[model samples]
Target: MAGSKIVVRFAIIVAIFMMPSLLWAGAMEIESDRMVFQHKSERAEFISNVHLKRDDFELWCDKLLAYYKNSQLDHTEAFGHVRLAQKGITGSSDKAIFDQKNNRLTLIGNAVLEQDGSRITGETIIHDMRNEKTVVQPRKGGRTHMTIESDKAAGTPLPKAAK
Candidate 1:
């Protein structure tokens, strides 16, 4: 009887130690020929010429990697010729960061963001997708938009927040 009791206690201890891993299917590993992500389960992966449409914003890229934490989207990184089409504006860059939880996007590394035929080039461009505000700062002399294509738009103008 005492031996049986010891065996039962050992089984219970082992189950308790494994409970967390069984309950939360954590850190999903997604790998394809293009992109890879390590996010929790229940998240989706868009890869290999990814096209993501959130409201008015349409993003296309050679590779897109995204993650979700606690059921809320955390971040996304688009690489290798990232292009964005929204309203009358189109932007292209080597890389772009899409922070869904923060409602912002930062285009980096030789980024050219254009709207209504007007374009700006800089090392870093931070856009507040929520308020439609764009801050463009060139590495040296700052930013300049093509006069002929200037939209004179007041806001940065992002799409509706993704749920």
Candidate 2:
């Protein structure tokens, strides 16, 4: 009877530790060819054609490593053919990191962000999700590039110039 009581208490404690993470965000779904979860380290590794979706955001990558703290999402690292989409915006990079605490996404190496026919490319891109701000950084010897579509391109008529 004592051993059973101890086991019940242990189960309750474990559930308590895991509750915060499950409730911190609405829901996060991940699919991968293989997954390895380490409860002691509070990390999960998803390998090969990984797809992750949370709310309206989606990400695809060859490999992803997600870390947790206090049973809540701490951050995630994505590598190889990293691509992300949310709302109408899309981003691609060689590597990316999503910091849950700060609500920021950092894209590194051949980073490109596109939306509504406009595109920005840089060596590094920092997107602050909470602030809805983005910063692009160029490579050491290269320059960041951006292409913005004009109103006319969207079929909006231009105002006539004074005669």
Candidate 3:
């Protein structure tokens, strides 16, 4: 009975501490298998199948490291099967870094971005969401790649082939 009471108390304490983070983005929530926070570094590391959710976007990764400034999200580094989703857009990469100072997201290793029917792929991609700009770069000696497909091309009825 005493052990169960202690567990309940600990659960309440954790919930209280996590409330502010959940409220950061109008009730944006983050969850993971484990989390470690370092006050001296002003950073928090979430490991194992991390998920982050908010009104405008969602992010998933195997691990995430968030650095805060003034108790606000300054930047983040996500590793292992990083994925980001927003309205009409989806992006994936092996690793991703969000640079708040530059207002850009840098994706590395088999990076890809897809919207509508078009797709952009490369070893590295830098996207500036505020400005709606993207720069794709090759890794080492590789080449950037893109495929643009029109909706009409796939949706239009084809003419019947003559016999």
Candidate 4:
């Protein structure tokens, strides 16, 4: 009886460790060449060709570190050729940090965001998902740049001028 009880407890612990995503609430999915999870720190590290998807949002990077709080995703840091896409917008950067609790994404190092033939480039870019706001910051001695393509240039019908 005592041995059976120990076996049951071990099986439960193994199941919890094996199905880490089951603890998360959303439909977030992650894939990578290799993954390591540290239960003590509540952290998971994904290495090599990491891909993450949640709803309409998708992210790709060479490596990603995900942190959890109370069995929920707290935040994530991505490194090496970070790329993100969501809601018709695409962005790239050398590194990125996503604060899940705050619904914010910060892109660092040669950050660029593009949509509908328009592009914004800067040293750092902050996207506030909850507020639908984006702010670009320039590196020291540099300037942020943006290019807005006109509707005519994009082959869209121009609005008629009021008479």
lDDT of 1 by residue, 1-163 (tens): 2212111121222234333233332222222333322333523445565666665777777767665555445677788888888888888888999887678999987878776656677878889979989887677765644434424476565678989
Superposition error at 89 for model 2 (Å): 1.0
Q: Per-residue lDDT for 26-137 in model 2, tens only? A: 5577777776677888877888878888889999999989887877778989999999999999999999999989999999999999998899999999999899899999
RMSD of 2: 8.3
Model 4 gets an lDDT of 0.82
Query: What ordering of candidates by TM-score runs from best to worst?
Result: 2, 4, 3, 1
Q: Which residue pairs show collisions in model 1?
A: 28-39, 132-156, 132-157, 133-156
Off by over 4 Å in 2: 1-22, 153-163
When sorted by lDDT, best at the front, the candidate numbers are: 4, 2, 3, 1
Of candidate 1, the 10-residue stretch with the lowest lDDT total is 2-11
* Candidates in order: C-alpha RMSD to true structure: 15.5, 8.3, 6.4, 8.6
In order of listing, the candidates' clash counts read 4, 0, 0, 0
TM-score of each: 0.61, 0.81, 0.75, 0.80
Give the RMSD in angstroms, all C-alphas superposed, for model 1.
15.5
Please say which candidate is ahead in TM-score: 2 or 4: 2
39-141 in candidate 4: lDDT tens per residue? 8887888888788888899999999898877656689899999999999999999999999999999999999999988999999999998998999999999
